[model samples]
Target: MTSLDMTREALARAERESAMKSRILATVSHDIRTPLSGIAGMSHLLGQTRLTPEQANYLAGIGQSVQALSQLVDDLLDFSAIEAGRFKLHPRDDDLRQLIESVVEILAHRAHEKGIEIASWVAADVPGLLSFDPERLRQVLFNLVGNAVKFTNEGGVLVSASMVEGELEIRVRDTGPGMSVRGQERLFREFEQVGEEKSRIGGTGLGLAISRRIVLEAGGSIAVESELGVGSTFVVRVPVGQPSDFRLRQARATMLSSTHMLIIAPDGVCREALAAAVTSLGGTVRLAATPADLLASLEHAADAFTDIVVDRRLADFLSEELCKHPVFRNPATRRILLIDPETRSTTRFLGAGYDSWLVRPLRERSLVGVLQGRMKGIELRDPINDNRSNSRWTQAEGSGLDVLLAEDDPVNRLLLKTVLKKGGHRVSEVETLRDLIAAATQATGRPGAIVTDLSMPGGNGLDALSAIRDFERTNRLAEVPIIVVTGSAGSETRKAAIDAGATELFVKPADPAKLAELLASYAARRAG
Candidate 1:
């Protein structure tokens, strides 16, 4: 046989193997996630009901386990797609700082449990918005930071982003036991775990491999620098497309030009980053690491800062004292609290003379908005007098909607129905495409939103969605929000759903809380 013919045969075999692997992964993903969706859904329901402390803890553990398993499935699926050359990057303009903050926020609980701090910093020069695939970028950062947190016990993990020569560079540095020379060589290889404590620190070792593929696909490069006893830092550099408008930059500069701000954060990195951002935007900044420093600076300084941003942790120490502080009470100065997302007693803080609150790890756009007075502060209402019925934040249990749910599986259907009902929504279920189309089109009253699973028994959800869209257009009706919740994670699947007029797409085992939030937002938008 000719050499060319032999090469062709070899290529054919490889292609067949790749296709088979992708198909197997898809099957595995669906099978595992189908059950996981039920488990996660039920746990979420259990959480709402009154439970003993022990039961709550057990439920939390179950939730975490489900998340871990789902993550594993996702990792395997992503790797398979990359290997099969089916991985695609969908880049769009998004808030880079917000994305980084979200990843850090998600992992902060774990870091705090291990007595380690996890923080993020985006360079002042890095535009507030950049063109990139936010979800894919999030996945890469999550894996890198998660791995860093898992391996580190003593110090902490710091994820920082900077713009270098028009390329977006992200560095994840950890004070963990670093890799040796030999270990570094195989670090990005599939299923390769290094270090003596590899068993103790568990992972499938496909994280770096998958991350590398994602970065490379985005026309980027990822590398690591490490020493045996010191630490490891993973650097990812990717070329970004359109940044925020130059006119907006000018506006930011103009708004902040006359501003003098005070930033109080215990974390040194965060404190400096805030100062840098402010300084870059043509503002003057003062840094205080402690309450005492803040007080002293206020007392000694001639001019009062226009804005005082206090970390919620430090505010706890100040407590009632903050309300009495001269600088905090000054009408000329805005009091902004840098709050953790899990902080629930915010009403008290807001009542105690805070003008506004920024959820930490802070996003640059939010900060700019707050500082510029473009983002309005919460209205100071009497806590006792305020029933909060009229407040924008009131959604769950406050208002309900008519929902049409399409799912073939009983367990999955129950999960969706329960979640919607729990949020006070009236749900109508349909198990087949025929029923779905009939209910959506023939019904007298329109549903506020439609939640559907893509792969039904007889016909696909996409077909039903397309039909619904056609019906809407034919009848000159307002388009309903058609949210697709599917097990398929393929880019093609996502594109197809969007093409079929799906309002949004969510992978299976979607968080009930987030789903509810989405519905609330949809309602809110419509009402507005």
Candidate 2:
């Protein structure tokens, strides 16, 4: 055969092999991840319980492992995208500090086990919002910090971010055994783990390599500085920008100067942060370091402070104290609580003593809105209070969703039903395509959402999906959000499900938290 013909044939084979590999990986990932969803979902539910510190720690470990596994699958998918030159960048205004904090918080569990502190600091001059692909940035941080925690056996990982001349410079420094000059040369090469240290620390070794690619794709430079025993630092510099109208937040914050707020928080960092958030509101802020100081301040004229925000440390213990305190009992005194999502249940404090609670790490807008609304005497449309759909995922008992679930396996069906029911959804279980048809065509009111499995005894999920679409068109029925979940994973099956009218498709091991969020969004949209 001619050289060109042979080369063409080889290229064709490589393409075919790549396609098959992608298909196989997708199926395997679905099979593996389907069960992980249950593990993650149940773990989340378990975390909500009043467990001991030991039990909570154990649950946290499980969560970290699951998260790590999820990231592995994501990395594989991303690698494929890069190879195919199909990696799409979606840039929008994102809070860079929040993104950095989220990365650190998620990996904090693993670091804690090794006695390594994950600390992060964003420069004071950094913009409140910057345009970037949050997912890609998250991927980069996840890989870099995750590796930092793995290789480091000593002090910790410190993430320092600053904007210099319109470029975001992020440095991930770790007090671990560092790589040599020769090792640094091959560090960012695909699947290359330089040292024996990396060998002992388990990873696919695609992390740093993938991170480098992501940085380069974002028009950024990623470089490393290291010595044999002095630990290593990964440096990344990317363009930082914001949307055209960046002053709207500042404009709103300008109005807070007329409002007086007494801010109380426990940790010095959090206290300063919360105080800064209040200051951004253009308000007069008096920060109290302790509950005692807050109480002393409250002892003054009730009107002295238009608003009082207690720390998470004080919210739960103050219900009775609030009733007894004359200043607190006054209806004009607006009280807000800075709360932890996992530890402090916001519902318990809301209406108990607090006017509203913002979940930590606190968002400036939420703080400003509560303070401003109170100042204007404009009744706050509490997202939770005004709309059940807003809190449906966390507080699902009142969502009132009529849900249709189709699954052939009794165990899977029961699991789905239990989760949906617990999530305040009225689920109608059907095991076959015939049953799905019956449920869809019946004269009764249609469900708010439908969950279906792809493969079943009576017919496949796509068959049921097609039937639902036809029925919707024939009867001019309202489009209900349909989620297709199946163990059978393939491009054809996925495309078919989408074409036949599935709103979302998830492979098994799909996190229930994600499903809950999706359902909540749909419910909120429909309600609105």
Candidate 3:
């Protein structure tokens, strides 16, 4: 054969192999998930039953196992999809802290079982809101943390993130067991668990391989460090654009001008992190390791501190010991508690007597928010509320109702319908443009919102959107938010949808929580 002919044959063989792998993975995914779903469903139902503590624990373990199996299947399919050139990234603006928190929470149970502590923090300079593929970023975090939890038996796992030279550097460090210099060579390669880790920690061994692919695809790099018994740290560095790429709620410039902060944290590293954040916010910081030290610092200070920041661990460990301390009781001091975002809630901390609290892996904007509010002696809110668009709806008012769903794909329609139903929304499903028009034009019992899929029969989704807008205008009706979800979101298609009046456009596999949040916001606005 000629050189060109040989190259063509090689390419053909590779294609054939990829197709076969994809088909096998697809079949296994369906077969495995069908049984796993039933197991998860029954286990969920069993969990709601009144049972002894031991039995409840057993049920919880079963649920975790099922979820682990499901995750493995998903990983396999994702790998196959990527190899087949089907994996796509849908970037959107989201809070990085919230994304990390969501992943940490999902894997916390496993860590807790091993008597491990998992804590995460972002550098102060890192923007709280940035544009990225949340789902992909989340998968990367989940794999790293899950591996950390799986291997670590003692000490703790830390998810630390920082922005360095235009890249977001994330490190997942664990104190469980480390690897050797020679063994690190095969870590990121496909199906290679390296050394004895494959036996010690049971996994399909595809997690790191998939994570590297995702990180690289997103214009990032991932690396690792390990010593035989010293545990390991995996570092992933991804370009997250410059600070201007973020939606800045508060200026990066120090807002803490002339403000004084006293940080009391049990972890020395945490103390330094807090101090650095305060310094960036244009404030001076004093560190305290104990309540006694705090009192001495307060007495010796040239001026009273504008804020007293305490780690929730330090405050609660000492119980009322700190609350009764003269420094804590001082009228001039505004108390702020630093907490792990995964395990801590604002209500819990607030009830424990902090005026306000900041989630850890502290962001500069969040630090400024807490300090700024306290400078004025106002009640402080979580950092998440600071950057997220504040929805007017309180929990009671945010309840969704009577949503009109337009989609031709039965599977997607049913899946979304069940999700909405479980979230307390009454869904009216329509497969055709006529049904959608009829539903929208109903004389009474209006839907709270309309969700439509593009490329449906009988009409273009953009046209349907325009018709809906025109109907609302002609009939003197209240504006109902329209959500467009489609597989194709070319610039022209997006512009067309927006011109016709779409509130938001989501590509396939949109986050359900986001969809619900949007719907709730519309409901609350209309009610207001």
Cα lDDT tens digits for candidate 2, 1-528: 999999999999998888877767766776676576667656756665577777866876787678777767766766776776666677889998789877776666566567555556555456778999997899899888888888888777877777677799999888788999999999998877876753545467788888988889889999999998889999999986655544664564466777888876654435655665556556667766655776777676445678878876766565566677777776887888765434435566675777776655444445566776733212222221011122335645657578889877665566677667766777888888888878877657878899888766677667778888888888887878899877644445667889989989876655565777787677778779
**1 or 3, greater by TM-score:** 1
Instruction: Name the better of 1 and 3 by lDDT.
Output: 1
Clashes of 3: 4
Off by over 4 Å in 1: 1-3, 196-202, 250-267, 283-359, 369-402, 434-449, 464-481, 517-528
Clash pairs for candidate 3: 121-361, 122-361, 177-231, 178-231
> lDDT, candidate 1, residue 236?
99
Q: Find the candidate with the highest lDDT and give its number.
A: 1
Angstrom error at residue 114, model 3? 4.2
Evaluation by lDDT, superior candidate among 1 and 2: 1
What is the RMSD, in Å, between candidate 2 and the native fold over all Cα?
Answer: 8.0
* Model 3: per-residue Cα lDDT over 215-299, one tens digit each: 9999889999887888899999988744473435245435566788888776543466567656665678887787677667877
Best by TM-score: 1
lDDT ranking from best candidate downward = 1, 2, 3
State each model's CA lDDT, in order.
0.80, 0.72, 0.71
